[model samples]
Target: MTERACILDTAPDAVGGALPAPAAPAVSSPESAAPAAPRRDMPRERLRTAGASALSDVELLAILLGFGLPGHDVFEVARTLLAQFGSLRAMLDAPPEEFEALRGIGPAKAAMLQAVTELARRALAQALDDKPLVDSPGAVEDYLRLLIGGRPHEVFVCLFLDARHRLIRLEESSRGSLTRMAVYPREIVRRALTLNAASLIVAHNHPSGAVQPSASDRRLTRVLRETLALVEVQLIDHLVIGTRDTFSFARHGWS
Candidate 1:
């Protein structure tokens, strides 16, 4: 599966049928107070009538972010964010620090955005953890993409699997510079033994968004595959994760 397939917006408007918008604040005349007026032509009202899918990215974002800072409305803030990031996917993939640095998005709003992104990752991880990965190669690719696709630096990850090929655990094995990572096969072997994992799928992200493996990447894969085999733990696959795609060694005949 692609990165787009993995990211899900879990907000009420995005998922289930739209919920009713809250009543507008009561208006007070000089003589008496009047009942709250009905909201109209607003994002929430539009979502209730049309549906979340009917709303634009800005509308959805505005709803997710309840209000905006002084001098900026929620829609304006949402538009600013989309303009800065260029797309909804890129906005969600952005680090919390990036969001915090933007105008109209303070610490609270940034945290909310960060939480949504993390929720998407955890939800995908839960699905992968519940079933055998071999039955769904697409899910594995989706999970890996969300895990490391947006990182500025390289991250080496390990998906430890049980004898039945179900995911046992996912671990960040190592981290390195934007272009280079030092991964140790012996350490991986040790971890597999410790976890009693019968098989493993390893992956690393390319900060440059290139899925092609380098000479060093190929050498490491060969050494790690051999080392894991000696311990009777299968090296199921090695995936090179890019921003939009993944390169699977197993799918490519383990070359």
Candidate 2:
């Protein structure tokens, strides 16, 4: 007999009757699987294609944060931050301790946020240094707001300008209690002379969020203007920065 016929004739239990039927594959439930979010809708991708300026404040923040905590998504974390602080500026200006207290913000994230604001401030300062202030009054106002608008105390700053009205230096001349500050016109004149500045723009902040200049503010402006004029240095403007607005003496004809 053929070898195949001899094996069929032997019906021994020892010989494994027949190979067990192939086992069925496991089936996973649809409810257990989550679809991945589309890449195009992600913040980083949107920023890359549409540009940073096109992104919302929360989106930019999400990029910085990189990821969210265990139960929150990155966008949700960013939204929580903004909602708690009220705005991006408030969040950035928040104290380190306070910032780190927020959910998903640790020392590293807080430091990153602080560094971004500082870089922006430095960039504005460098831009002022590169061009004449007269040509970029709006930039001057923005720089001043960023520097002092959020301070908790009064701060007097001076932007010393060269003959061409380019910024020579920016100085914080005085800091005082929350409600009051004293500025000296004579000392301002002395500094102008020392810096060989041909013009100056003076500014101060009101922690109370009032952009209106006080009687004392006007008096100081007049004194400084006359004092600088005696030495042929012009008083270009006096700006008062408040939380939500800024007062421009030039705009109001006070300078």
Total clashes for model 2? 0
Tens-place lDDT per residue, model 1, 1-255, is 221111111121121222233333334575673222332137789898998999878778988987778766676688788878766667888877787678899998888888898899888887887689999898889878887987778889999999999988889988887666667778889999999999999998876666777767777888889989999999999998876778899889988
TM-score (all chains, Cα) for each model: 0.76, 0.78
For candidate 1, the lDDT comes to: 0.78
Give a tens-digit lDDT track for model 2, residues 1-255: 322110111111112222233333244588863343552257688788889999878778878887766666676678778877766777787888887667777788888889988998989887788698989988888888888988878889999999899888899988887767767677788899999999999999877666777766777777777788999999999998875678998889984
RMSD to native, candidate 1: 11.7
Q: What is the C-alpha lDDT of each candidate?
A: 0.78, 0.76
| Top candidate when judged by lDDT against the true structure | 1
The TM-score obtained by model 1 is 0.76
Pull out the clashing pairs in model 1: none
